[model samples]
Target: MTDTTNTDEQDPAQAEEGAIMRFMRATELDTRLLGMVAALLLIWVGFHFFGYFKNGFAAFLTPRNLWNLSVQTSSIGIMATGMVLVIVTRHIDLSVGSVLGFSAIVMGVLQVNILPEYLGLGHPLIWIIAVIAGILVGALVGSLHGFLIAYGGIPAFIVTLGGLLVWRGMAFLIARGETISPVDSTFALLGGGPYGAIGAVGSWIVGLGACAIIIFLAWRGRANRRLHGFKLRPMWAEYFMTGLACAVAIGATLLVNSYPWPKGIVRRYAAANDITVPEGGLFISHGFAIPVLILLAVGVLMTILMTRTRFGRYVFAIGGNPEAAKLAGINTEWMTVKIFALMGGLAGLSAVVASARLGSATNALGTLDELYVIAAAVIGGTSLSGGIGTIYGAILGALVMQSLQTGMVLIGFDAAMQQVVVGTVLVLAVYLDNKYRGATK
Candidate 1:
């Protein structure tokens, strides 16, 4: 009986050791994951409080309002994805907003006039052409910036800053200072319409597919690492994280789609002798935006490129130690150029989406876009000195910026105050990031 009791005590201790080991392994597997999640939760809580104090609890997490917030976030979020790559490589592209604006204007022109008249395109087909054109234009602009930066010895910041002005000027020239009104219905659909509804559905499908692919890849990667005798997180912990990620994705989708139709309505009585009339209210889904899907796709692709590719590794090397990377036979210059080109292309895509949503292209379309993009990247944890960053982090940063903008607007903050607040946040984020890095070092 004494021997049996001793064995029982040993078993419990063993179990506790095992549990502790598992927790430690998980903590090591993804150190930043918890912090990132915590940051997001904190942002939500802050927003919730702001809404509650200003407009009561119901204003917080209204389904329609949530959907609007997502849509508003999409545009900047998409650009930030590309900005992540540029920042990871210790570079910046200040011209992205201008590039976006230019691309959008071009797409609008094509959709409204060129496609219908020259290409004989239908509604959806016109949208396809516009998207294609936007991407191509973006790529070309990026390549130009890359060429100047990589080969001409021009700083990326300078080149892109010049590009910001050049492109804005070009936009004015293209649209002649007029707000290219009466955008094609087809093009409008690309911004956020019924196609946007289709886009939301598409987002779910893609998210699921991405989750599956990630799980498979992660499992295979773990197996390979183990086989090669590399350090790896335990299998169960990895699976748990993967499951949790998938659940979050699914939950987000459901939450965004939960609002009732005809979200708000109003009634009017003409006069004492006149009859009353009821009119259907404005629905949030009515403005459901497709830009969100585009941003998601861009984010996913950027994450894959950053985390899974050799090019991504080279980017880190270049950022961390350019001289060392060059000595090690990495094509540093070419890579820089390529990165810039890629950024330009992304800018173009963003511009197109924004333009479509606005249904017009104007000289002011991309003004100060570079500042926002740069701020987003820096806030997302991309080191200004280069080397360490993640695409997902940039996306999060962009979302935070977007949320701040949205919340401020909802709370009736003016443009000047918004700018002041954003600038302050950017400074604070940079200070915190630098402090964290210094402590870690």
Candidate 2:
């Protein structure tokens, strides 16, 4: 007994190992995000070759393709941001597609059919009212779902599943199995169509503005942390991250600006106007579609909500442990209601964007969209078990998934193979997450 030694403290290797473990634990989330970036790069490179060699074209990496990807990703990206919140609270909304479809149908009917027929409201006024009304419809539907689940004591899965069928049936009845066309031009401007494009100059200006804001925020945050005596990342690390963010902003702007107007379209427009081509004018296509801006706006707001607000922390806490949360005086039911309502609202926004992009609304508007929205969030590293996700990562996940779809089509892969690959990737991603999560624990 007198000879007992403190082997734990005496072992030099133990200190080094403990330090390494601490660093690993601190960096796990950052590591996962970096891995996602690397995976996206790999996917892009693989698809670039597949499309170029297999399809005998190099369109996959062009600015035109990139711009299209951004637009296509925006719809799902918007919905996925909300889904991250939903799933983080250990809930899901299977009815988002149907909700989206019904909202768009309501807006189209009001704007194109009822408003003009009954009230004769001005075009701008009709568009404004229709948008607000559509969003309210979404919020209402979301509240209904939230109420049924929160107050009625039904499981979220069952509640939203029922909503899926009910809302989809309602959409069919509302549209009478038809499509509505020639949407209000004013409203369509939000859809990333030609009317919605933020011209090349505007895109550059916005990008620079965003970069400046990002830099300012970083500096301010670091300074605040120092003032509070909080630990900070290495100064060099902060500098590198800020530089990287700026490079990405500038790079994306340049990429979009590189795409010239399609040759046939340019010639047709020029001929229609009886205007010369200006002797070698580049005729560059517009940059940064409006939908991209919408996504960015939503993303910024969501990032702030998740990273800087008490509501976000409560949501995570509720997800991680409901009973523990209750013991700590959390009102989980009310929070769940709010979360689902928010999801519904986002679904409505996606509906507006979808309808605007197509310049019409149909009963089939958002069929299967729920799958894509959920996949985007899950693939972006949002754990299905809840309490973890990020808006930016989900947005990137949408882009990556959409890129796969676009690339597969370019390489002539059929729809079945696309589904198969997507399904496999989803399973693999979830498995990896589980393994990584358990190891960290």
- By summed lDDT, which 10 consecutive residues of candidate 1 come out lowest? 263-272
How many clashing pairs does model 2 include? 0
Q: What is the lDDT of residue 391 in candidate 1?
A: 80
Q: Tell how far residue 206 is off in model 1, in angstroms.
A: 4.2
Q: Which stretches of candidate 2 lie over 4 Å from their true place?
A: 1-29, 118-122, 263-275
Q: Across residues 1-441, which tens digit of lDDT does each residue of candidate 1 receive?
A: 444445453466656677656586564644454565676667667777887788766354566767777776777777887887788788888888888878877876777767788766565677777788888898898988998988999998899889888988887788777676556667675566434555345556755776787688778878898899977876677877778778877766666656534422212213333645436543332323467777777887888788789898889899899999999999998998888878878887777767777777666776777788888777888887888888877888887787778777777779999989989989987887778778867
Worst 10 residues of 2 by lDDT: 20-29
TM-score of 1: 0.84
TM-score of each: 0.84, 0.91
lDDT of each: 0.75, 0.85
Question: What tens-digit string does per-residue lDDT give for candidate 2 at 144-183?
Answer: 9998899999998999999889998898898897898778
